[model samples]
Target: MVAPLSAWPWENLGCFKYLLYGPFLAKVLYSRFHDQEASEYSWCLHILVICALRGLIHQIWSSYSNMLFLKRNFRIIEHGVDFKQIDKEWDWDNFIILQALIASMASYMFPFPANLPFWNTKGFIAVLTLHMAVSEPLYYLMHRYVLHGNSFFTHHHSLHHSSPVPQPFTAGLATFSEHLMLAVIIGIPILGASLMGYGSIITIYSYVLIFDFLRCLGHCNVEVVPYQIFKTIPFLRYLLYTPTYHSLHHTEMGTNFCLFMPLFDAIWKTLNGKSWELHKKIRSNLGKSGRVPDFVFLAHVVDVSAALHAPFVFRSFAALPFSPRFFIIPLWPLTLLALLMMWAWSKTFVYSFYKLTGRLHQTWVVPRFGFQYFLPFAREGINKHIEQAILRADKLGIKVISLAALNKNEALNGGGTLFVDKHPNLNVRVVHGNTLTAAVILNDLPKNVEEVFLTGATSKLGRAIALYLCRKRVRVLMLTLSAERFQKIQKEAPVDCQNYLVQVTKYQAAQNCKTWIVGKWITPREQSWAPPGTHFHQFVVPPIFSFRRDCTYGDLAAMRLPDDVQGLGCCEYTMARGVVHACHAGGVVHLLEGWTHHEVGAIDVDRIDLVWNAALKHGLRPVSSSC
Candidate 1:
């Protein structure tokens, strides 16, 4: 029969065992000798033997696990397993042994007895245990109330979440600040117990070391403990540490904060309820049967569409001005070209519109896109021009006339007549008409009517009429569609007539003011003072208009008629100095300064005299004249 299997293996290793046992037994025997030197020597030798045996056992177990996984084709390397990720890799048993050795050596140097007077062993043990209990609770409270509640959590704790699924070693991979905080917490109790002369410090230190080692073991991703046992003895299971439980904490945060006990988390309710659910889901998804959803098909369609149409939509509007006659020819080539140009133009037009309106205005017919530079449009440019012209009239110490034709078709056909109203000063006359020709009738004013403002003349034909008036040497400001259009008209018009045609778009013409801003105190003395809010505040002022010089004493107080005030004729006032100072002093009637003029030195002396006279009649006093 085959020799006993166990005996066969032991017989071959018997000689090697004897070789190790002989030296160990000899040391033990030598420690009991009557000589102090021999006894000390033996004791040192025995300590080394025990440490070596423990290290051997640890290595054997680790190697056995590795080999078992290898046999099962479950290589940790294949799964990206890393040992450095484990936190707190201090060999607790070995550390304790080394500490003991150092302490023993120190005792010899001091010649102190192991059992010193005043150090009661039993009392020391009790005190040490109590210190640990108190320190743990304090640590928990500090973590919950301070670190987690304040901004510290955002800066410090957030770093840990950088890796959601962490390896074992990552547990101790805290920043230096975090490590220092831990050291303080641990040192407080350790130092307190040591200073109190409680039990043997060595034994107390041993317990602390063991607890720290257990914490490290828990963080390690090794499933050595049985799940069945954990289920059966619930209380004992809570006490025992496990890799799965700790791993869950790393993956799903806000859980498992306690290193030695779960009571702290339970009492504070900080334990994450979803930890178990997340762990189960992660594990199930990692299994062979799990499948990732296919989003590639949908993503491809979106990518292709964006690539094909983005450029076309962006370039269409810019081509509009060049191809004004594009719509006349509906052929694909012309149509395509028109669409492309419009796309480019629209980009700039929309941007400028939003800049002025503070609202994004888009049309379905106009393809939306983003680009640099905004071209002025009929809608925005006309309003802006009128506002500027009004301002200019005020600055030039001249009168303004505003005309509105409600019937667009009739105005275009020259069938409507003009409605004229003089400002309170009778210096500015507003002419409202449905037709350009009707507005042109203002040019036939009597010599005394120094300034004539024509409104409702915004079409191409209206601009031509304004140009004609300019040729006639009348200071004519015309509100048009856009700057681009104004420039085009200027290019085509006679040089002598161009200067007369002040191309104030409708937008600029609407902002003109004819009143002087004054304080409440001066109101009783003057009837021409304005208190603000009479003019359109939302209207955008153009660069050419001068609001400060254009605004009269009556406009600031809203005393001037709206029809007399040009809306879009000027730039915004830098500051309402006349009004601000007067308002502060409670004065209603501030001295009126004459309007700002586009051609300051060129303003007709007679026209200025007439404006001053008109303002005087309106109860405005010219206290001083810079002119």
Candidate 2:
């Protein structure tokens, strides 16, 4: 629930909310352009840099803490963050915006130190002493009494507490009034130092950076601070708070209301008794191995910008269907830098996870992109990554590992056939997930249809779809130039049904066929040959565009996860909420069914209906696509 207080006016702007700094940015740029003295725009530039740095700090902590490879065992809360939490905390950086705006205004109203030196030992000491004396207690008092005890403040502060599993940005997720109070608490020491003629640029930067750093650290949900220090110096526990310490506040609302220091909590006898014990307990388990997921979706990055859609990078962005955002264009440099780094030193990593029916499901990414898969030289490297991932999953005793998108490319690794062939003794099931993919596409076709046009006629999915349709006595116009491959697939069908599969090499052959099954991308000219109202069913990667207005296009094969799925905070590429590509769902079905066979290489045409039925049996529903 939203606080009764009014929200930030620019809340709906989403990414454009940063434009609130336009006036300050313009003033800084204009002042610099006019060749003014350093003091004229330096402070404004400082405020901008500080705010950006604060955001960067939060991003770094978020990335690190969410990295299961790094700190999975150390997680205080094992449950995944859901879409509701993500939507609520979408504007986690609102406090930074508020801080920038207030600081910019205060620069004009108050007489800040001008032409300040880089370092001032006296100023640094003064700020620290003043924070300990004034800021800490005042914040604790307001947070404990007003925020918790009063009705209005309680309503707003509840927003922050809503996120039971605190993330790095969760520290800043609050209402305008709460942030305003916080700004005052944080500002008191800096303003006090300036008034006492002890302020320096270094003091302001150092103090604020530490403040932001500690805030992020406390909310990171991982126990990074060593308990040894606290063990040695018991007094230090009162002076500082750990991630586990603050997490208790969110879970147990009435206790541990101190800002960054536990001293006040102890003073007021409000500290939770479990804070230190829980901190030590979580820290002790940090070195142990993490739990293995029941199912793993081996996925690959699509492109540079889409990398940001990884749940760890941007929770809110990943929750929605992915599309290129103009606002994300500015961050291309950082993503590009990350891309280059991954290209140089990338490995398969756990990208996200969730739970369904008591089973843990994880999505792992092979740091290669879609374009990289097409490169001849990168094929071996990509396969090596996939192979290693399969081996790791096998070692971890994972029940099923599903290959998604290009990860199961026949040309690259024979749809994950290479690994299964070489490691025949492997215990883990390597599933291409194409059986269900074919099922979803073929099932969507009208049963009354007498004929259908097929492209990529000899591909694994195309072969399965054509053979399945042939068994139903549907005349299939298989579009292929290679007669040998077509003949081979035709020979596999029943003798009586074989005549239904006919080879057609040209797009003109499909002009009269209204039901077109596209497994390969076709050009506008080729698409033009289709008759008006032709419904195209596809299982193509980077699904084809709807070039003809007279015809309709279908999305790639996908299925909606069961309603009981938990912690499903991110979408699977362009799929809608709770919907996942059929291949991914295929793996889930495999796990739920406890299927023992390795579902790699060629898809089993006979099992299409069985798998489809099994999916329905387990409550997985096909994602209905119009047109």
Candidate 3:
């Protein structure tokens, strides 16, 4: 457990934690209405603006580092950040809030008047000189002697070093004491410049932002600085540090203790001898391609808000199970505009990834939303994006790709049949993963169930469930409008079991059945026909609401990923931590089982049980029903 002082006070508030700045915001509004002089409280507003700009800089670096497309080839650490690391660093912006508050209080306490000039060349030179002479050595001595040499400070510093693989935000993940010390190291030079009578607004903004920018750059875990320049000048290497240089400090813990410049380390004889060599080695591999994934789960966005839940948007928020926050309501219009842009120009891109049992798995989003698939004009565009993703995966030697959710909707792409039929020679196995979906739904049913009610009985999952249950001598009341479609599915079962697959067109026909298998969205009126205590087992997208309080409803077919899974930092849709929709798991099982055939088109009834058993064999547990 973390010590009370080690954690931020507002950590648990989530997005609403921004309300800590409410007083400053209220001040800005009050000044605007009262037509107050710009000099009176303008610095207060400037402090808030600078704080926001600092946050934006960190967010940009973080998002850039996490993007597989942009940073795949240059990743310093091959493994990704896990949920544990994300949780530990959830309050990364605490220091920013604290700094802003301190600055606000200092404004009134200090004798300096407001409206310092915009630019001060003498101030910039003075601060830059003082930073090198005073700030650099002060921080180096304090960091090496106190932070690492002393055990008390080391305990607080350990929180920053906890994440071995660093992202930009990792720079700010530290105990409150450590951050307070950092604020002092940064404050001395600015204070010295002011005491020398050269301080100005630009000087303050420039110095602090550069300090934060360099801090973020070192923790980005990507080698962006070229080695050739360092080789040519040699002295420049000590003036600026690379990501790999700082990364070595995290791993080794005793060397490279200088804040940003390594000159102090070189002068003190504490510089790691291999820093330049290692930086060159990592830089040499920058242009090479990343590894090919073994499995890919092709998915699409569900709605505007869910789009913000992507790993790149907000790492801390994405680490938790997805649900819209009250704070996100203000950003709704912006997200909607982003969606329209995606609809007009976006293609498939990698969303997130993880490694399971030495095999690489990734989720690739199709750049379309659920509602857009139902729009008739958007069908062709959606299918085109999916095809491009499939062909890209095949070209990269990916073994299997599972179509998730609406990406494989029967009405859109014929459950991925259109792609396979069009390109027969493709090596990558295309999978709808409905075999596991049917298995999860069927296994959730009561074993003693004599009669079961089924909705969307003619759909792919519904047909497989009806046929598989009929083999067990269970009666299936398949509700469908097309008698012809019902007869076609019944003929596929054994002749002796054909009578067990009965057809019914109305919800009233299943009033006596206590088990309801729903493949389509059903209204409360339709759900009313089920007997009390009925459990609705469903495979529908955006799962139906649990309107019957007296009854139970199972979540969409899903399975908990194996315990050994690594680098999975976000939840799949709204699934509990570590759980993924069954279709995504099916892709994993396909790679684990080494099956060569594509599990596309109508789900094979025979493979329903086979897939379920394989998932269990590999430690993927089925999700239980809940009210």
Candidate 4:
């Protein structure tokens, strides 16, 4: 009995036909051509040779155009335009190599059969032309739907999208699956024609090569053909495609789906309706800028030179001796190492260059008469004036505290107090008891103290302190290098303390005797002030005190948390005076509860099984059951 309808004959037909067409065609062709007719075969040979040459020339020209477009129009430094939108590397080297291997196989293993009726020279050419016309619409449909569809886009099509404005070289740069799909789609019509005795497979192959060349040309950046001619004659327009139309496909995306003609897109309403408007605008802008197309020509030269020389340059390097001299001496290794280092250094250099230029290009800041402040980095004579102000302040018994040394690490070290050990006279203390403690400490300062100097104050902390001090009617002098750096603090600094936190340079503070008259002065590092009510809830515990349920050690000794956690916990709770064990447990409960209740300090409690158990058994989890 015949197999069920589910077991279709064409299930494995593709694979079987793929294996048969190549060898069968070659044998038939060999049988038909006599030994004496080898010379007469020159006609066929010349045609094939001419076709191949034309395809190659077209590819080269297209590639040149694309390179020019990139070099001239590409905005590399702009945030939205250039490298940010595209991947750092093309990353299609493997895909290209695989395609080359497949093309090579297709070239060698497949030859047209002369013995077959479908292999007749003129008949084959006619059928091949018809096949191309039919296949064009299919190609458009596949490009519009399957390639652009969300399901397959990322895996199969996103690689093409990597180059938003692609070059000609990128035309064939697709995933292997995409290439195979193209081969199947393209091969089917030609195969069908050959089976029906309408065309030679060789003619179909020639058409495919020419099609690839034109496709690459369509993507080229240079305008090889005039837009007016193509726009005027609909049938003739189908013969010659333009770069502008194809480029819009890559640039705007999902707009121009047709390859050879705009007919498909026009029929489907996928054509970019404003293409002409955009073209006119682009031309007008280019004209206003006095831009010429010479840059495009120059870019082509560069691309050609790079392509031709790159192989030789790479081979020369590869041929070098693998010795210490080649590897380490005479700056080769040093040069490579320098280049590697240069990758990061170049970014820094570019940033610095732009910053310098920006500063140089900026208009001078004219000071408002009575409230005049020196420029932040005026190296001429501003230092002496600043020093004199500081001396005057010191003479008035105001203690100058500097918090320059308080880094993030030191802040963590001092139980998140953010105090540095640089100042000997500044009484440093960690008064806040919780994670939001950064604010609480400043709020609860002694009322008798005329001025409290906080050295390491971020904008948030500075804002918090300024707000608190302004409420208490205390003078809070906040000294920094630049007013711009502390602009946030200046804006948010309480209106009452607007004049109190008088920003001054170190030199200015040192110069003025009146600055010393202020009860106490603090000079935090530039831009360190934090606004009022700012909190750091997610305070990390030292590794020694952290217990990970997922991790286990060979012995208990190997599994201990960091010693700093123990030291801080003991010092903050166990070693403090008037510290009850119940209060200590309560503090832990508050910390844990804060983690759950607040978004700022939320902790992952799923792994805190032991802590959860202890808190529950000892009634330390806090009474708010909703948490």
In terms of TM-score, the best-performing candidate is 2
| Per-model TM-score versus the true fold | 0.29, 0.93, 0.93, 0.36
Which is the better candidate, 3 or 4, if ranked by TM-score? 3
Candidate 1 lDDT score at position 181: 53
Instruction: Give the candidate number with the greatest lDDT.
Output: 2
Better of 2 and 4 by lDDT: 2
Residue pairs in clash, model 3: none
RMSD of 4: 22.4
lDDT of 2 by residue, 98-164 (tens): 9988888888876554556677889898999999999999999898888887685567877788886
- lDDT for model 1 comes to 0.34
For all candidates in order, the CA lDDT equals 0.34, 0.89, 0.87, 0.38
Instruction: Give lDDT tens digits, candidate 4, residues 1-627.
Output: 432221222334533523433443354356456554533343244334433454464446533542321233322111111222222222322223333334435434343333334346765665556555776678788888988988677666776677554545457556656766666655655555555566564665566666666766665554455445645764765444456667788777879888677777777898887555444434334433322211000000011112221111222221222112332344454444533453333221110000111111000101111111223343222223223322332343322211111111222223223222222232212112222222223323444545433322333334445545655666655545556756666565557556655565443342322112111222232112322222221111111221223222111000111111210111111112111122123223333343232111111222233333444443332311212
lDDT digits (tens) for residues 485-522 of candidate 3: 99999999999999999999899998989899888899
The alpha-carbon RMSD values of the candidates against the true structure, listed in the order shown, are 31.4, 2.5, 2.7, 22.4
Q: How many pairs of residues collide in model 2?
A: 0
Winner on lDDT between 3 and 4 is: 3
Among all windows of ten consecutive residues in candidate 1, which has the lowest summed lDDT? 293-302
